[model samples]
Structure formats: structure tokens, C-alpha cells
Target: MPIVEELIKEGRIERPGIGVTIVEVTDEMIETYGFPKGVAIYQIMPNGAADKAGLLPRDIIVAVGEKRVETIDELKEEINKYKVGDIVKFTVWRDEKEFVVPIKLQQLGG
Candidate 1:
């Protein structure tokens, strides 16, 4: 199993939908992407919940539910507050635009 999967099974991480790989948004990244502090979507998995929700790679996630997340760890921590089948709202920054999207969570191994 992948390390992420193992972590999920061990309850050390939340089971996010196979939607995106995220990285901490640094000042350099902000200058490059023209976004403020947040978690950048490094990659978006095909046919995943985020994909289905129209989230694209390079989109910066600034908030989950009602909490702002500036780091990848904060994003993961916010995600961990919910379980599979829960729908969460995400505030994203893309192409100088900010929008909110709803994504339904899924089991890691599902």
C-alpha cells in the first residue's frame, strides 16, 4: 500500500478523495501563481471528486468549510475533521479568480 493509504488506515491522516496532491504555498509560489498563502493543488486526479467538481491543477485552496488553511498540514487537518460521504466546501483561487466548490469525500481505498 502507498504511504498515504497506510497513514489513512493508521488514523494518522484523513481519507481524502483521490482528487489532488497538495503542497504548501510559499511566497515564491504566490509570486509565481499570483495567489496568496494557501495549499496549491499540485495535481488533480482524473475522474475524482475534485475533478468532478471542476477543480484543476494549480488551483490554490484557501479555505475548507469555514476555516482558512494556509499550509498543506492545515488543509489536511481541516479535511480530517470529516469522514467519507461528507460534503465539504472549498474556497479556491484560480486565474486570479476566487470561487467556492463543494466536494464529496470518499474512502481512501474505495
Candidate 2:
């Protein structure tokens, strides 16, 4: 894949990331919290991309661009499709409403 090629050429692969700890929203969680299926932001690193973009804990990420992601892996996969510093629009669900947040991805720490 492109990641392998990049690593081979550059000796390292810089992955795009929004600094946040996330948890997958299971069916049980959705039923208990009355939330839709998605990955919930459990924590945000201070001054990181997510924090800078005003993303907060408990925000549910429902989509990356036009791709709907219902699990942590899907979110990660979607995020990896972009380069660091690329501004990607994420569909977030918060307080029972859905909105888009533009986040500039930063390089993830090794």
C-alpha cells in the first residue's frame, strides 16, 4: 500500500491523526444512551488537532467525509486515508444533533 511505499522511501511513515481516545459504540451503549452507532470520543489531548478544532469528549464521530464509520477501526482507517495537515470534514453527533467539524490532521506520535 501507499504506507509501505512511503515508509520505504522516507524511512518512516507519518500517519494522520486527530488526538483523541475513542471507544466504539455498541448496540447496548446506543440503547442505553439513546445514541446512534459510532465511535465516541473518550478523551482529547490538550492543544492537539481535535482540541484545536473544538472537538470534545463524548462527541460521537458518525462519519469521515462522506464515509459512515460505526467502529473505532473504521474511523482509524478513514483517517489514515488523508495526509497529515489535510483538513477533513467529520460528521459528529453531539447533544442529539449532527454537525460537521473541519479538523486538520496532525502527525501521530510514534
Candidate 3:
């Protein structure tokens, strides 16, 4: 099983279905993505909210709403500030292009 599944089963984390594992973007990653450091998407769950919003693996999330995020913790903290069903804009960098995508947050089990 996925680590995320294990975490969910252990009640150590909530399953929000944003469905993406992220890491802090490093200097190398920033150079590769042609963007400043941010939260780098490592994976995107199939058919999940992030996937539906056009977020893909390797996309660097630079901002959530109007707040800039430089680390995974910052990104998660920003995300937690909003409730499920709230639509928020995410600024992402992919393939040397920057764009904004709106995502409607969802809870996995409620």
C-alpha cells in the first residue's frame, strides 16, 4: 500500500483527495524547472482534484491563493486555511511556463 494509505489508516493524516505528494523544490529542481524554489509535485493521484485541475507531476507550486509558498509545510499550512469546497487559485510552473489553476478542495471521507 502507498505510504499515504498507511498514514490515512493510522489516522496520522487526513485524506483530502488533493491527491498530490509534494517536496520542497531545491536549487537543482529550480534550475531544471526554470522557476524559483517552491513545492515540487512528486505525484498526482488518478482522477483526483489536483489532476482534474491540470496539476501534473514535476509542476512546481509557487503560490496558493495570494500567499507565496517556498516549502511543503508552508503549502500545507496555506491549504489548511481553507475549507473543503472552497475554490482557490494555485500558481504553478511547468515546462518553463507559469499558469494559474483553480482547484475546488475536497475531503476524502467526511
Q: Name the best candidate (by lDDT).
A: 2
**Cα lDDT computed for each candidate against the true fold:** 0.83, 0.93, 0.81
Clashes of 2: 0
TM-score of each: 0.81, 0.93, 0.78
* Candidate 3 Cα deviation (angstroms), residue 39: 0.6
Whichever of 1 and 3 has more TM-score, that candidate is 1
Worst 10 residues of 2 by lDDT: 1-10
Question: What is the number of backbone collisions in each predicted candidate, taken in the order shown?
Answer: 0, 0, 0
Residues 1-110 of candidate 2: C-alpha lDDT, one tens digit per residue: 58689889999989999999899998998889998999999999999999999999999999999999998899999998899999999999999999999999999962
Query: Which digits, one per residue and each the tens of the lDDT, describe model 3 over residues 1-110?
Result: 46588587776654343778888988886576566789888988788789899898889899999999999888888888776688889999888787999998877543
Candidate that beats the other on TM-score, 2 or 3, i.e. the better one: 2
Q: lDDT per residue, candidate 1, 24-87, as tens digits?
A: 8888877875778998898877877888899988899999999999987888889877787799
**How well does candidate 1 score on lDDT at residue 17?**
60
